[model samples]
Target: MSIQPVSRERHAHLRWKGFSSFAFAASTTLAPLAAAEISQAALALPLAFIERDGHWSMAAVLGLMPGQNLYVDAGGVWLGRYIPAALRGYPFLIGARADSEPPPCIDASSGLVTPGEGEPFFDEAGSLSPTVTQVMRFLEQTAQSEATLVDACETLASFAVLEA
Candidate 1:
């Protein structure tokens, strides 16, 4: 997916329309896995824990096919107890910068974004609205957790407990 940095100058006038269905996720082959520290909270869910290329992750196993998600109902609604934080923070993502802190980025193609509709991204004062602030916080936490997961996986691989 093509992601662009979210900035007041660019996105101030836009609104987050909110996704009406899970069709976008249903079409994807895989979803982002929770970090090891947070995986236990989702253990009872229907997803499967998988480790690939030294990265410990999870995947929703719908069927025997490559790209299938059974959790998606007839109306494209996800039927699971815990939604992956990655998916919950739709459209917005944390992107690493070359010489500055990572900033929240938005998938330009996501249907959740619009010129006029739904929750406003910025308030009348040209500042981020509460909804946008919450999303940014979620993305920040997700990025930090992902980094920790990568480090933990690397350490495990060094000890021969995980395969690279």
Candidate 2:
């Protein structure tokens, strides 16, 4: 998959179509959760703290093993009331860079980015459209919350309240 940063200069011509299925997340066993959504997500999904490269974050446990997600059915539909923020934003992601804040990116291969179709990322004036603006804001907020989530999880681990 070609994952590239989104910018008015590069992605201005691209259009974004909404995710049609949870198929993209069908193989994911753990979906990252922000601190704000932890309570709601835990109501329906088993919550667990996951560690990557020694960084901790809370996540929703979707299955017992890797490449399996019990919440997503054979049809790629998610059978849950609260979709994790990570999975909710399909094709769009916040990418981390050295000494910089995360940038919003797109999974170009997800078939969600198209030319002359769906909602435009930018308007004719080369500015973010309303739809893209809302999505970008949500992604940025989620990224910001990730730090708090990590701190909280680390605190939980320190208290011997969480298991990776």
Q: What is the C-alpha RMSD of each candidate to the true structure, in Å?
A: 2.8, 1.8
Per model, how many backbone clashes are there? 0, 0
Q: Candidate 1: list runs displaced more than 4 Å.
A: 36-42, 46-64
In the range 1-164, model 2's lDDT, one tens digit per residue, is 68998898888877989998998888899888888888898888998778966977878999899999998999988898889998777788877798987777889889888887899888898877888778878988887787889988789888888775
lDDT of 1 by residue, 1-164 (tens): 77998889888888877677876678555555547435644564455545766576555454346677666776879876666666777777878788998877888888778897889878999877888889898778776776676676667667887653
Kindly report which residue pairs in candidate 2 clash with one another.
none
